[model samples]
Target: MAFGRNKNRRRQDAAQRNEAVKGAVRSKGPGVMKVLALTLATGLLVWGGVELRRWALQSPRFELAAVSFSGLQRASRVELLRLAALTKGQNLWALDVGALERTMLQHPWVKKVEVSRRFPNRVSVAVTEHVPEALAVLGELYVLDEEGEPFKRVTPGDGLDLPLVTGVDREGYVADPDQARQRFQAALEVARAYTKEAVAGKPERLSEVRMEGRDVTLVAASGQEVRLGEGDSEVKLQRLARVRRELGARGLAAEIIHLDNRARPGWVAVKISSPVSERNGSAKQ
Candidate 1:
């Protein structure tokens, strides 16, 4: 009876151990499945990223949709459109925006450019065109914009009433040069200001404003010369404009007004040229 009881107890213990082993195996099976699922998910994500990049570069869905511009007058719409290499069928993601911007900036008239991508199928471009402030008659002929930047090299366009700048050499127009064009710029400003206020309304009011070395001279419509001295130029220009307004009614007298004096109270000299009657009387005498 004692041996049989011991055998029964051993059988019960073995059965319990077998049940515990089966429970552990069941738990480990789920853990292995979870790890396999995560690995597959990671691989799919990486593959999707690569496919997306390939599609972005090669697909035609992101092609250019439209071309637009601003601050452009001298250049026609068609001409500007032609200058841009981006067309309706060109891929937006494939284009180098930097290279395109550089090309547009080379147009002589284009001052700034902005490019943006609209997903799915659109690219937009915004451009700021250079406005010509003066006609720079350099060796190759360029239009000088407001910032004194020379751009286009075309013949003078119509309806431009700005001053014409001449005698500026090639070195003066380099990307960055000395103050060679400073004097010319000053002359241009004076001319523009004078025209805007006094002369532009009266076409032939002043014929030419010639800068000879350092001195600035103004040639009147009636063949008279007005001298503007070096330094303190704004005051000298003001004096000249005042004189022109005062004497313009008389239509530019045969006199020369010299405002070269900045400290000694300034002076104006007139060559009376002897009256016609006096000349006649002298002839009779």
Candidate 2:
């Protein structure tokens, strides 16, 4: 009976040990699962970070693919195209707009230029060209645009029908081009006035235009000299036109007409024809 009790006690202890082993195995399985889950999450995070970086790099961000140009004068399409070609394929976000503007302004024909970027691959450029109003005969003839800025050198045989301006002082020429332009503008205004009157009447009737300080002197077709004061140009022109019309209608002749005084009636200087005695003496009889 005692031996039987001892063997039963041993079997009970063995069963308890086996149960403890099973519990340990179950606990270890959950710990391993947790580790695996953590590892998987970490791997997923790494992969996502790499993908995000690649997406950022590969995204079609703003790059210069198209260049638009405007405000260009006197520059041909070919010249403008050449100027724009330098910025092709450049990243618009990283591009230096000021630098690009300077580049265009460096071109011979470009007077003023502006550069801007459009999103997703476009660059826009606007430029103004120097237009010449007169031919400035320096070392070489340069065409002075309306702004009086001299731009290009004139070549022999170039058929630019521009007015000639002489007697520009060296200081005026060497100073700021804007100053030169101002001179050119004043001269251009005078020339335009002369041209308009000539075109309306007999073109050859008006000869040369000589500009004095705030004054213009004109030699008419009838060898009469006229003086006009500056400003009130339109009013002066109207008065001159009336005088010419009256003289033509009446067959009246004068050596001079002064429209300098708008408040007074038209004034004239008469040159009496050579007396009959003097004419006969000079006649080739």
Query: Candidate 1 has which clashing residue pairs, if any?
Result: none
What are the per-residue Cα lDDT tens digits for candidate 1 across 66-145? 66655676555466556666677787778787887776666665678777677766666677878766666667756677
Report clashes for each candidate as comma-separated counts: 0, 8
Model 2, range 78-109, lDDT digits (tens) per residue?
66656655545666666777777776776777
Best by TM-score: 1
TM-score of each: 0.67, 0.56
Clashing pairs in 2: 63-121, 71-127, 131-145, 132-144, 132-145, 133-144, 148-181, 205-221
Query: What overall lDDT, based on C-alpha atoms, would model 1 receive against the true structure?
Result: 0.66
Root-mean-square deviation of every model: 7.3, 12.3
